[model samples]
Target: MSLHHTASQEATRRTALRLLAGLGLYGITMPSIGQAFASDAPGWPEAAFKAKTQDEVLAALYKGKLEMSKDVTIETPEIAENGAVVPVSVSTKLPGVTSISILVPENPYALAASYKLADASMAMVGCRLKMAKTTKVIAVVEAGGKLYAASSDVKVTLGGCGG
Candidate 1:
């Protein structure tokens, strides 16, 4: 067999082994992913997560109105083939950003996730959010005791419940 052909076969074998290992690890962790989050983090905002509508969720989380700011940016795929695991990242150049929250308007629960940051912490956060269907993803940043928001639409071809 030619050396080039042998090398290609070796690369394919390595890729398959990697995929298998990753799948095994993911399967082991899948069960624990639904476990309750245990931490010292105060202000869980349980009500916000239970809020059904975007307006109600915003009111539940923040005391004041949120300002749409170009300074805060939400990064998400324009089209997600699998809604089960859509990657999202939120960041802001604004100062004193204490918290970041992800919102999905079309989901049963409007508030998908939230993150807390301190004065010395970075103003950026990344998470994987499940979307039931195509919808708008909003990032809300609490900075300097004020609310700022940025949004982007993601088209989910498949519902996030399962395959």
Candidate 2:
């Protein structure tokens, strides 16, 4: 066989192996991708039940009963220009997460949102949220019959206030 042909074949073999390794790791990590059974209407509770102030929301969502888990992660921009439409995403590496919810305390309603998951599946949910002002955005994951949470701050800037 020609040297050039052999080299090409070798590169293809390496790429195929890399692809297989990635697939194998994915299978091991997210085995329950399509088995998450969540409620049709996993509604959020009243604001009083969630929190009022930003700190209160963080405390309620990420403290004591709501322990932060390494399996869950929340993503949001460090700075948001228009508080009316801030993008946020919640994702979990844990298996069998029944549902996930996002909450913003300073808003008119503290329970910003909730999302049900498929049975035996990992979930990654993204949505836009409104912030009355700079506030904490939290992700709460219901998995293995318990609740886990993660939180991050989103800085909202007015015309001259961010200075």
Candidate 3:
């Protein structure tokens, strides 16, 4: 190979090595990054995720009952053409919302998604969930240490999660 070609290859090798070294250093320096993903991290509702029924999930997560509320709003398609990727969004006007959870009662696991919000954070969450069939999509919010819920029925034409 020509001398110029050899030099170019060496430069490329050095650049790649530097990039790898930088990434390694980043991983070593960021210790909390690992903790953020740990399943046993504080406040993670492990039992709730494993619960089968909505009542069980609520008991596991909140240890209290939820009341239907007009302040909690659920925005989802009335009919989902495909059950595999139904978009769902939840928002609440209730003050001091600490968490939001989406539940699909007919799914193998009742809890589709759950998010913990910071103090004074906007009480809104959006996610896609897989549905086994047509079912009511429930949005539960924890505000001021109380549970509030809203639900909307979504008809799925195509089955998702093996219907």
Candidate 4:
């Protein structure tokens, strides 16, 4: 056999071995990739994401317990030229924050985004959200096993979330 042909065959064999290894077929066990990055992991609030009203979402996520707080801050543009990509950020001075959630009451689903913070992690998060129109953007922070919230108004010229 030609040397080039032999080298090509060797390369193919290595690739096959890699494929098998990736699939955990060669006496190896592989973790479920889906489970590793699933949205349905433990403590995920599925019902809150599906809630249509802000009250429902708050209730589903925080058991209807929330208080207005000045320590929580919401930063967003007063006017959003594009509703499809409205930038929003949340930060809190409250100690022992465990989670932060963003809510848009006018959107199809009031819950825009939610995040869980690790112990001693900074109480801050940022993301883009779609808006249906001019609406209040609320940031809810969970600290010391209690929920506190703050809100700001954002006006959208073009409707996102199907207007």
* Top candidate when judged by TM-score against the true structure: 3
Worst 10 residues of 4 by lDDT: 1-10
lDDT of 3 by residue, 1-163 (tens): 1111245445754655576778776454444563765434333456778899999888777746789999999998999968889999999888888889899998988999888787757999888889999899999998878889999999878546556
Please write out the lDDT profile of model 1 over residues 27-90, one tens digit for every residue: 5534464568643122355677889999998777677888999999999999996888999999
lDDT, candidates in the order shown = 0.80, 0.68, 0.79, 0.80
Candidate 4 — which pairs collide? Answer: none
**Candidate 2 lDDT over residue span 1-163, tens digit each:** 1111245455754555566778766455443656765322112233324475545543433333566888889999999978878999999888778778788866766768766576745588999988888888878887766678899999988757644
Q: Candidate 4: deviation at residue 122, Å? A: 0.3
What's the TM for model 4? 0.71
Model 1 clash pairs?
A: none
User: What ranges in model 1 sit over 4 Å off?
Assistant: 1-42, 159-163
lDDT of candidate model 4 versus the reference: 0.80
**Which 10-residue window in model 3 sums to the lowest lDDT?**
1-10
